[model samples]
Target: MNNDIDSALARFAGAEPHAGLAGLEDRVMCAIASRSSSSGLAMGASLSAAAFALVLGIVSNAVPLAEARAVSTLAPFGAPSPLAPSSLLLEPR
Candidate 1:
């Protein structure tokens, strides 16, 4: 290895290792983390808001709600269920 290259690498790895980028890293991480957290919080909040609205609609429409909703069904109306939990693992006895 050339002495010049060796010395340059040694100094680079030994010292701050690019002072400008190093300093910028902390600030960048803080900004990124903050933005990510805020975005996540906003998304979660919006999901919660939508869920609340759905529940409110269901509750308010309960009286006029379809009676067919009482029975468990896999289809929109009624049909053989392909996705229902199977009791095949239970003892036949």
Candidate 2:
């Protein structure tokens, strides 16, 4: 068994690589370069999209709606109505 294993190992070590594996390194390098370039393009596109969304949000918030009215009350604007169920729970029973 040991002799058979030693012979098999020697045969494997002395074997020549297949012809189909020629220029494998060049092909692998080319594929890597192409993938890296595409990733850079994707990153740029995502950043530009985020910047556009941010600018749009800022512009939308800065401009007031035409149909909205300005109120002069001193109370907080978004406070819940006094008659609401949630507000009723806070009142003295």
Candidate No. with top TM-score: 2
Per-candidate RMSD vs. true structure? 12.6, 13.3
lDDT tens readout by residue for model 2, 1-93: 579889999998999989989999999999999898879788999999999999999999899677676564434457666667777898998
Candidate 2 regions exceeding 4 Å error are: 1-3, 41-93
Candidate 2 residue-wise lDDT at 20: 88
Q: Model 1 over residues 32-88: C-alpha lDDT tens digits?
A: 998987797789899999999999999878766555554554574466465444533
Residue pairs with clashing backbones, model 1? none
Cα-based TM-score, every candidate: 0.29, 0.40
Off by over 4 Å in 1: 1-37, 64-93
- lDDT per model, in order? 0.74, 0.85
TM-score of 1: 0.29
